[model samples]
Target: MTEIWQRPWWFTNSSKPLLQPTWSYLLDNHGSLLHSHLFSALFPAAAYFVICTWFSCLMLIGPSQWRVPRPQILAVGHRSPSERECVVHTLLLSLFFVLPAAVLQSVLRTHIELPSRAPTILELGMGLMASLLLFDTQYFVWHGLHHVCPGLYRSVHAKHHQDHSGLELPISLAHLLPWGLYGGPAYHDKHHKSHKWHLAPYFIHWDRLAGTLAP
Candidate 1:
């Protein structure tokens, strides 16, 4: 039997075709179409629209009690955006940012040499941890700057604050308190209330070190 590392990363020893025949045919013959703006951008944009629309609809029609248990983060006398406004902004994000970025990334990916080796379980775990740490640090700094800089806050980050309700996922995972150094939805809800804190998404180390952890 061939060793695991000898095969491609996506393969098992069985060497089966993971993708559908239609997709494999397109990838073999019309590869550029998969990398085209139609597939890379428009498809993702449409998917985003569907997901956001579905989530919005659920939040609208679902019982309020089904939402995650957390204190409302809106300031006194502050009003949350209406459903229409949320829908508009979500659509705008998909069209302008998500679509363009997807196409750009597809173009760039063709130039990049992707990893072909199957990572060991330990390596996979280590890679995931490294990614989380790097992302947490990057976001911590970026989020802090957005708060301290008035113009940057207004132009870049203020739109994110528009939905201060912090009911994004609306799952009942509230009981799973922010443990394991991971910020649960409740922990993130705290950030919406106290914007200067809980800046990192995956790990709490940066927030603790920067003294930005919520009290």
Candidate 2:
């Protein structure tokens, strides 16, 4: 097997300067690694958002088995804030979140192993779960804080609760507006109803465990 090595100065000193990333230490940088581009940072993020948005639209709006099972819970044929507003707002906010996320992804993917990666299935699962837990914990805490302070909720969060189905928000920019799952109107509606409950955008148990769960 062939091995590649980066210049010594390319490495940055961290808390553990000797400990390189498992993937980098193992496989080094293969020729197949993605080269980071100044202009291309946001492309991957935008593409991911577009694919997810369109997929949610086709699944929920169009006829498909993936449609919400309890149709009664959903507000059918409902519209709010007009289509133009949704598009404009979504595009604007996408610029805010997508740029940073794309840059981060680009950095992570730039030196990925070509044929063999260090993260095994278990490692990947554990990392994913850790990220989810961290995100959910932060979400749960901030959500509680926002609601507890009337000024905070009224000034910013109020716009989110405007519509039960998140139609008032945009599909792509929900995470930025902090109103995720707006594309999945059915699930997202559950979040807006009865602020005492359904606080998680990903439907995590943070709200319930925090003793904030109420009808």
Candidate 3:
């Protein structure tokens, strides 16, 4: 008898695959190895470049009205890394962390059981909310700890706060105004500016309960 981990979920145990035949055939051949390499590594890296490029272009050449109204957040006389520097750093990060992690996930894929059927709407919604909450909780804890511990802040988190090494933040168009409930771009921008509050990424309640929510 096949082990439970070797089979799909009970509801979707039908012979039909969730994916179309051509795609299913490809998955049967290469499976998670191809998926991880293509999606987890290459797709994300490619997306980062493309999205960052768009952001840079928009900020540099787009209408002045579209720019963030706040004064430049960098401290006086502080120099942010140049475009080339950011690109080099991103490449190194992708090579060392992203690619290796994807490869590792692919290698371990067989040990993990996944549902074969497409999720119901309710399941999808629940999963998204769960993911958001989990991410927010983890982010809040880690970020708060870094701020509270001077050594951790100086050694690791300082560069992230100072240099704004991540380009993903600027991709969100909602930077002009803070969301009432969710931690929108403006919420995250406030955190970047203050570096002492708004540590939670999705829910504002975490910061509120922790007394770290900024006005």
Candidate 4:
């Protein structure tokens, strides 16, 4: 069996995230579409489904004595987010990530040599860690900048902040890089309360480091 890289080739030590033999095979065969759907839609939907179900269960099973307050919104304005919008936006968002990676991989395949072998489990773990690091830094920086920049906040992010009442999976996970286990509503709810919690990639250290952590 071929070993996959710990991270995508580009993010890996190999410096060839795009130029790998496995990717060509993965993308060209029937398996490619399946992989694309899995990455772009199915897997994320699964997370959505699970999180929703979990919360539903909580509402159903949690102690009756425990009362939760109505969610409070920021000064920007308060409005319930649209579920339809979240799902549609999320699907399109997934495509953006999937398509670019595919195109880059295809383009690189013609010019560069393949990786020595698939990344081993350890290597893949390392790659995951590396990906998380990159995503978090970029996520926080991007989110922070948007918060500080009124034009950006008003134009693009305001739409995102509009729906603070419930968990909108697609919109919640629609970050430039938000496919991880952490990219769901529970963690993201903090952002809705105030732009102070839940920086991207689901990691707290960066927020804490930046002193933006509300905890």
TM-score of each: 0.64, 0.52, 0.63, 0.52
Q: Which residues of candidate 3, in runs, are more than 4 Å off? A: 1-77, 99-110, 165-179
Candidate 4: tens digits of C-alpha lDDT, residues 181-201? 444455566677767676664
Extract clashing residue pairs from model 1.
none
lDDT of 3 at 9: 51
Worst 10 residues of 2 by lDDT: 1-10
- In the predicted model 3, the residue pairs found to clash are none
Scanning candidate 4 in windows of ten residues, the lowest lDDT window is 165-174
In the range 85-170, model 3's lDDT, one tens digit per residue, is: 66676567667766676667655655443444445444555787788789789988988899899999878776566545222244
Query: How do the residues 90-131 of candidate 2 rate in per-residue lDDT, one tens digit apiece?
Result: 566577666786677666665533434344444555787678
Best by lDDT: 1
How many clashes would you count in candidate 4? 12
Stretches of candidate 4 above 4 Å error?
1-70, 74-78, 91-112, 164-185
Residue 133, model 4, lDDT = 76
Winner by TM-score:
1
- Model 1, TM vs. native: 0.64
For candidate 1, lDDT tens digit of each residue in 1-215?
A: 36756765454334233434545566678777655645765776788789778767777787775454434555568676776887888888887888887778766665433223334444556787788678778888888899899999888777777754434454433344355477756677678777877888767778889898887
